[model samples]
Target: MARTPFDAGAEFDRQVRVLTDLGYPELSGLGPERFGALVAPLRARAMAAQESRYEPGAGAGDEGRVPFLLVVSRNVAPIEETMPRTVLHGGRLPGFVDRTFEPGSLERFVATEETLLPDPDAYLLFDIERGEEFCGVVPRDAMKAIAGRDRTLLTIEEGIALVTHFPQVLVKNKCFSLGGSRCGDRRVPAIWISQKAPKLGWCWEGNPHTWLGMASAGTRTGGVA
Candidate 1:
C-alpha cells in the first residue's frame, strides 16, 4: 500500500482547477477568484502538513492513504444546482437526481449528529472510505459497522465532491451510499452510475443492495472555507 508522496501544494491547485471546471465558483456565487480565496486555508493546511514531513494522505492505517475530501456544504453549493454539472464519460453524460427525488426532497436529508461541519461553507475531511467491503450489508447495519471502525458516513454533498474530483471512483458495481445525511425517514442517499452516468438517488435504510456500500470519513476539520 506504500506509494510516492504527492506535492500537496500542486494537488490543492489541481483541486481548485477541478472545482472551477465543475462550476463551484458560479454555483456558490463566489466567482472564481473569491472562491479560490475562500478555500485558501485548506491549501495552507496541506502545505503545512508537507513542511512537517507528513504527506497529506500519510497516516497510520491503509485507509489513511485516502486523501482528504474537500467538501462544500449543500448550503453553499446546493445539490439541486451542482448535481447536474457532475459529468461522466469525459463530460458526455451529466448527472441527475432520480425523478423520485423532487426539488426540496433533499432538503430534509441533513448531516447526522455525528457529522461535523467545521466551516459554514467548506472544510476538509480525512480518512474517507467508499466502504466497498460493506456491499450487500443493509444500510442500518452498515452504519453500525462504520462506527465500529470509528468512522462516520459521508453526506450527500461530500459524496458529490468526492465523485466530482475523482469521477473514476463511481464505476459500475462500486457505487456507494451517503448515510451521513438522512430525513428522519428510512431513506439513505447515495450516488450511483445510471444510464452510463452518475445519478443521485436513495435507498431504503433496511434494505441491502449488492452494489451499494456505505461511504464514510474519519472526521472533519475547519479551513479557510
Candidate 2:
C-alpha cells in the first residue's frame, strides 16, 4: 500500500492528545488565545536577540545575522483578531502569515524589512506549512540578490533550494510544536519548521515507549520482542 499524504488537521489533533497526556490542561481546549500565549514568549526572545545583535558599528553586515521565530498553526481558523499583538507591539517583524486555506486572498504573507519591520534581520514565521502553501513565493528580483549568500536564514524549503545548488553552506532545522487540541480519541498534528533544513517535523509528544523502554532497558534497541 502507498503511504498516505500528511493531513495537516489530523496531525494537529494527534499533537493535542500528547499535550493533554503530559498534563497540559489548557492544551485540551486549545484556542486562539491559548496559541497566542504559547508563542508570545518565543516572540519576545527572538525580538530581544535581534536587538542585542544590532549595532551601528556593524553597518550592512548586521543585515544577515538576525534570528527568526517560525510559527505554525494549521487548524485554528484565521481571523484578523488572531493576528499576533507582539508583532505589532514593538513594531512588526518581517515575517510571513499563512492564510492559504482562505478563499480569494493570497495564500502567503511576505514582508521585507521596509514593509514589515524597520530592520529585516529576523523573522517570525506564523504557521509554517500553511504559510508555505499559502504564500511561499519570493519575488524573482529578491531571489537574485541573495542567491548564494550565507547570512540569510531562509525558511526550510527556500534553504533546501539554495543548499542543493550550493552545498558548501550549513542548514539548521529547529523543531517544536506551537499548540494543539484533542478531538475524540484523535490528536491533531501541529505545525513545524526549521531554519536551515528543508524538512519539517511535527508530533503531539515524543513517543513514550521509545524513550522509557529503550533508555531503561540499557540496549541500543530496547524492549522485548
Candidate 3:
C-alpha cells in the first residue's frame, strides 16, 4: 500500500471531529477543551512527524502500518462501550461483542505490565502494526515474540480505538489480536470479521488461527491535561 501525502493537522482535526461525533467528550468528562489538551502532544508529533519507512531488517510488522494510533484511554472510553462503536466499511458495518464476553469479563482484563497509560483519558501509540507477521502464531508465543522484539502488544482499548479511527485496517482474514490486555487466563481478546461486520471476541491463548495476527506498537505516549 502507498502512503498518501497528508496534512497532519488536517487529519488530526478530522479524527477529532469524528471522535467528538462519537460523543467522546462526554465520556471523558473533559467537555471539549480538556479533551483537546489531553491529545495535544499527539497532534504536535503528527504535525512534525513524517511517515515511517521500514529500516533495514526492521521486520514484517513495520510496513504498511500507521505511524501513530490515537487512543482514548479505557479509564474514560471503556472497552465495553467502545467495542460496539468500532464501525467498519465506512460506518456501514456495525461492531459487536461476542456473547462469550459476559459481565465482569472486561473488568478482569487490564493493561499488561508493559502497556502503560500515561494519561487518564487519552494517549498515543507509535509505530502500530496489525501484526500481519504473527498470523498463525498462538497468542502465548506471540506475546513472547513481541516482548523479545522490544515491542508492546495492543491493549483492548487500543485495538478498539484503532479500528474506530482507521476501519480500513480491519479486513477479512487479516484481523489481529489484543494480547496486551488479559484476564489472567488463557483467553486473548481480538477484533475479527463476523457476518461482514467487525466483532470483538476472545481466542484461547494457546490456540493459533491462521486468520488471527497479534497487534503491537513501538511505544506509547500521553500527557496530563
Candidate number achieving the greatest TM-score relative to the actual structure: 1
lDDT scores of the candidates, listed in order: 0.80, 0.25, 0.78
Provide the lowest-lDDT 10-residue window in model 2: 213-222
Query: Against the true structure, what is each candidate's TM-score?
Result: 0.89, 0.23, 0.86
Candidate 2 segments exceeding 4 Å error? 1-29, 47-51, 56-138, 151-225
| Candidate 1 lDDT over residue span 123-173, tens digit each | 877667778887899999999988898887899888888787777677677
Candidate 2: tens digits of C-alpha lDDT, residues 126-174: 2111112111222222223323331222332222211222222211222
RMSD of each: 3.3, 21.0, 3.8
Candidate 3, residues 75-112, lDDT tens digits: the string is 87777677777777555766888899888787888887
How does model 1 score by TM-score? 0.89
Model 1: colliding residue pairs: none
Model 3 clash pairs are: none
User: Which portions of model 3 miss their true places by more than 4 Å?
Assistant: 1-4, 48-64
